[model samples]
Target: MARLRDLAKLIRTKNAGPFLLTLDIMFPDRRTYDRVVASGVIKKESMARFFSVDESKVRLFNYEPANAIKVTVPRLVTSGDPADTDLFGGQQFGPLVNVEVPDLPAA
Candidate 1:
């Protein structure tokens, strides 16, 4: 099974704001990006489950020009909150790294 880490050129997470964290998955090209999108492995519901956030709070954006998929979810605690270990949310993308992405359907 090809994992997300293997398919994406870059997978990163960062603080969107004090209350939100954003995950960016960028592919090397549109073909790769489309494969990931079509595979349906990176949707809002799955992301909500991965981050333990409410489904309504998860937002996904597909930018074909950039060959990227962006997902934003509410943080459990404020950015600087004592309970928040990831001040910059840079380490929050671990859950998605190994997500198994099935091969694209044969045309």
Candidate 2:
């Protein structure tokens, strides 16, 4: 968790702009995931959509990815929550979360 915080701090200082961290989890484990969530390094809601998984089952904050990257801000397009599909009577998966790192901001 400290490492993640350090990484965020480093990126913030070096880039001086909004960044995106993509956490790709090949194998999902509970304990490791919980630790990340408790640390509050990344936003849970953002992560859930990033992985394209159920937010309820998978807590974004708790998730630890085998690989991650600090990139530039992305154009987020939120469709809706997965749980709302039943009510909407249509398959409405959450919006696609894409990250596009722009030029580093001036310090």
Candidate 3:
């Protein structure tokens, strides 16, 4: 939890635009998972569904509940020519890069 908060602060300081953090957990008990979800520390859209195949093992996407974090940063786009403004109107645009961190166990 503390780590997550620190990460959030770091992200804010970086001033990166349009980022996503995904946390993945493996085979966690229902109660523990629910409690973590209830914390509201993660965004709703970042929550991934969980599937339990056995009492000891469960699988979920890299999301808050799963303990995996993903950070997405937009890529910089440059115009073909400095004098040509038609392509970008004197600006450049590009898509964002998706960064996926490894999974972490429940704390």
Q: Clash totals for all models, in order?
A: 0, 4, 13
Candidate 1 vs candidate 3, TM-score winner: 1
lDDT of 1 by residue, 14-103 (tens): 999899999999999999999999988999989999999999999999999999999999999999998989999999998789999998
Which one is best on lDDT?
1
The residue pairs in collision within model 2 are 33-62, 37-61, 37-62, 72-101
- Lowest-scoring 10 consecutive residues by lDDT in candidate 2? 9-18
Q: Given candidate 1, what's the lDDT at residue 50?
A: 93
- After the best TM-score superposition of candidate 3, give how far the Cα of residue 55 lies from its true spot, in angstroms: 34
lDDT of 3 by residue, 8-45 (tens): 21221121222212122322344433444455433333
Whole-model lDDT per candidate: 0.93, 0.32, 0.30
Candidate 3: list runs displaced more than 4 Å: 1-22, 44-107
TM-scores of the candidates in the order shown = 0.96, 0.23, 0.23
**True lDDT of residue 104, candidate 1:** 80
Query: Local error of candidate 2 at 74, Å?
Result: 2.0
Where model 2 places Cα greater than 4 Å from the true spot, the runs are 1-28, 44-107
TM-score of decoy 1: 0.96
